[model samples]
Target: MAHANTVLINALRRTANKLSSGTSYQWGHMGSCNCGNLAQELTLLSKAEIHEFAMAGRGDWREQVEEFCPASGLPMDLLIAEMLKNGLTTTDLQHLEKLSDRKILAGIPSEIRSKMKYNSREDVILYLSTWANLLEDELLEAAPSLESLLKWEEPIPIPEDILL
Candidate 1:
């Protein structure tokens, strides 16, 4: 499991919560789709705002990702930049939008590993939760050890009477 930043984990959780709680999900709509939800979480933009930005571009999420230019000041590009800042790469966003990232899928349980349709809300939730778990595992692995925690210089001495 690769280490993922807290920002990424929090965003994934927020997206999943929104999805599971009946936030509007329209796969055909740019703002309500998979990538859009993630954009919402990372960029703090509404679905309508994301849709408006996407409309300024030439294609859907996949195409937009393909043509992403960090230098371009388009809203969609700006949204992508926000996601990137939160630790997602362009490839990560692309895979997320396409529901085709092998690494994320590999972490999912085999029983539920069937092909995931890009527009399915349930699948999106599954994907987000799985990704969050992977990130959480990485965080656990990188956590400071007890020895490290106890290594402060000039540590306070315990009272001898307390030992009794």
Candidate 2:
């Protein structure tokens, strides 16, 4: 599972909500595709801007991620860097674009998983929600225990005169 940072979680949920709410989805459009939508949520760049940036490079999100160079200063690279800083890996981006991450797919019910396709908006929704759930599970596992919380909550002792 990808690291469960707050930014990443918010981006995933926002992307899923946008798509579910009838955001224009076109498989062939670079700006409105699966990864593009998520990129919009993360980078606050419009689809047109994302598409323009993508066109400045070759191939799709997968190729862009594969060829990412932080020093290149390309818009797509910069956008990708932002996503990485928020806890997504290039591998996760590739999988988001292609819907081909075996581990993530494996967690989906076989009936639904078998029907999923990369360019389908519903499939992307399923993928994002499932991935979010996995990340949430990881976050929950790493949460501080009640004992630890109580330890931190214990009031520091002070002389009664301090209250005067």
The lDDT leader among the candidates is 2
What would the TM-scores of all predictions be? 0.86, 0.88
**What is candidate 2's lDDT per residue for 98-155, written digit by digit as tens?**
8988877887999999888898999999999888877877787999888887775567
Angstrom error at residue 155, model 1: 10
| Residue-level lDDT for 61 in candidate 1 | 84
Q: What is the C-alpha lDDT of each candidate?
A: 0.86, 0.87
81 Cα displacement, candidate 2 (Å): 0.6
Candidate number of the best TM-score: 2
Q: Which window of ten consecutive residues has the lowest lDDT sum in model 2?
A: 146-155
TM-score of candidate 1 to 2 decimals: 0.86
Q: Tell how far residue 41 is off in model 1, in angstroms.
A: 1.3
Residue range 39-147, candidate 1, lDDT tens digits = 8888888999999999999799888888998899887888887888888888887777767788789987777778677678999999988899888888889899899
Model 2 alpha-carbon drift over 4 Å, by segment: 152-164
